[model samples]
Target: MLRVAIQVKELISSNVTSALDSMSSSAKMLHQLQREIEEAIIALEGERTKTERNLKRLKATLTQNEMREADWGDKAKAAMDHDREDLARQALMAREDCREAIASGKDDIAKAKADLKEIDEAVKELEAKREETREQAKAQSAADADKSGCSDAGASTAEKRLNRVSQMEKRTEFATEDTASARTNASVDREIDEMRRASTVDAELAALKGGAKKAPAKRARKKA
Candidate 1:
């Protein structure tokens, strides 16, 4: 049972660490973690039920032993009253055996109680961690939503800027001959600036994608 508890603890720890590290898949990971914890709890409850039944049996046995010991004592007294030394000696020996059995039963009951306590503690810890994981998953989902909203807002702003630049270029193309050369040069400069901005954005996006890919690969290696 102790070994089983330790294994559950290790599994919980690993799941939590992996979920935290893999933000993109945190929801799935946390869901899996919750299932594992529930399974562990079920297993512990089963063990607890068995231990409780055994404890009850042990107490019943102890009670019967005590009653038998009392019966032997009564027989021993009756034998003495009748002046039967051999019968009295046998009764006394039977009482001693009952006493030994009572002692062993009490010890067994005590150990069963200890085992139940340990199982209860493990169940409690798993429940608490399960709740904590749920909260973390909620927080991660909110963070992802915020990130997506920010990205959409940025793309919208970039689209509006590009539209304005396109309008300016159209106006320049329709300019009179007197200012046509100057407008053309200005349009070329604007185009160059736009290309530079687009290139920079693409490079940054590619780098972000590379980092995202590396994170999972690194996690896979660690898991292996």
Candidate 2:
């Protein structure tokens, strides 16, 4: 079986390659999106600035119109008290016109403020999205790099094989030594057995001789 190190290294390399590819794609998309976001934000800001200025101008105009309306009312009141009916009517008409202008300006200001708030919120959301994309891309790139730099298992497997062969050689040497010792002990055992057999035969022969001598002695005693 192949060593785990080799297989794992291959897997890591392949996975890292895939991860890097994905990261690259993500980065490209992020770049494009960031550009779009920036453009949109710029355009929105420009429009917002224009709208704010318009709103401010309208507000100032509205204030001036209100002041004019108040002046006209005062004039109308004075004229009415002085018995100038035509003059009072003209002032009252002018005041009504100013009121209408002020109302229109107020509406414009409100619309402009609403548009500015919406643009500001949109810009903030885009920024947040851009930040998230950046972080994700960074993490992916780091992971990919780590995977690509992984080591292969062939070297370790070769080392292990060498170690196993060395151990086997040592075991074989021990077995050879054991076999030689057993052979030496067997030769010594055989020699001791042969010597014991010869001693037994000699002892039997001596016993026979003694029996013979004793038989002769008994016969002599009977004769006497």
lDDT of each: 0.67, 0.57
Candidate 1, superposed: residue stretches over 4 Å from native? 12-26, 141-224
| Candidate 2, position 127, lDDT | 63
In model 2, where do residues sit more than 4 Å from their true spots? 1-26, 137-224
Clashing pairs in 1: none
CA shift of 134, model 1, Å: 2.2
Give me the candidate number with maximum lDDT.
1
What does candidate 2 score in Cα RMSD to the true structure?
58.4
lDDT of 2 by residue, 1-224 (tens): 01222222322333223323442433333444444445555666677787788888988998899999899878876665555656766676677678768888888888888877776766676566546556666775565566544234633543443343223112223224577778879988878855764464345334444554576689899999
What does candidate 1's lDDT look like per residue over 143-163, in tens digits? 666664445564464455334
Quickly count the clashes in candidate 1. Answer: 0
